[model samples]
Target: MKKIYIEIKWAFIYSITLLAWMLLENTLGWHQERIADQWWLTLLFIPFAVFIYLLAVREKRRRVYDRKMTWPQAFLSGAILSVFIALLTPISSYIINNYITPELFFNAMDYSTKNVGMTQSDANEYVLLTTYLWQSPIGALAFGLATAAIVALFVRKK
Candidate 1:
């Protein structure tokens, strides 16, 4: 536990960052008026996510390995961080869906049914909170591991 404290800390930071991003999107009308554009607009968060992974792995390398961490060591640290992020994703998503942008699912369903030609039932099933609660953690783990793999390469030191 103590050995991976940095990963835990960074996981919290990433979760907070995710909340902040969702709030920003909601403030910019992405969750309502600009709901159609939200799908593509959310891609903008990729860089920020990668940056956080880079920072986490780099910090682990410096603090735990004394600046001499190997690629595998950095990757392992990042993988641990990714697990932490996955564990926290459901809670973060609940906050976003319920508190930060309560209208998001409704807005998405409306847009999908009207513009995307999705059936009402399909929209309801796909856009609901339960789906997101499960999907968010899976997405976090997949993306987190991928980001960790890449970030590890760059952060690894001799």
Candidate 2:
């Protein structure tokens, strides 16, 4: 169960870091002023991805697997982290969207309409769909698991 604990700890760290990063970005108006225009912000995922991989693999290699880890073990650790992230995302999403910077939601809608060529109605629907569906728990789970599977491939020690 130590491995499970490690995965959970890392997951919590990663999730919190993600929330902080998002909050900082939004607070700085990056999401509002620059995100749509600057495609490079999307590359931020690469660092987070590498961080997740390193945390999972390094912990496995150091503590649980003891210098060597199998692919299945690496995958399992990543999956456990994913599940935790999936579980926590909803609460984080709610807090961030509701309390931290609710304006981003509306800003997103406007950006969608103006830049993405979406009509007002379509933008509204898109926001509703993304908020209720794509950013929801199920969507988090799906994305988390997919990320875990891919990260595990590189994280596996042997």
RMSD of 1: 0.8
lDDT to native, each model: 0.91, 0.71
TM-score for all models, in order of appearance: 0.97, 0.81
Model 2: lDDT of residue 119: 97
Task: Say which candidate scores most in TM-score.
Answer: 1
lDDT of 1 by residue, 1-158 (tens): 77899999999999999999999999999988899899999999999999999998888878878889888898898889999999999889889878999888889999999999999999999898888899888889999888888998898789
The segments of candidate 1 whose C-alpha lies over 4 angstroms from its true place after superposition are: none
Off by over 4 Å in 2: 38-40, 129-139
List, residue by residue over 38-71, the lDDT tens digit for candidate 2.
Answer: 3466457557755775676577667877767776
Predicted structure with the largest lDDT when compared to the true one: 1
lDDT of 1 at 137: 85
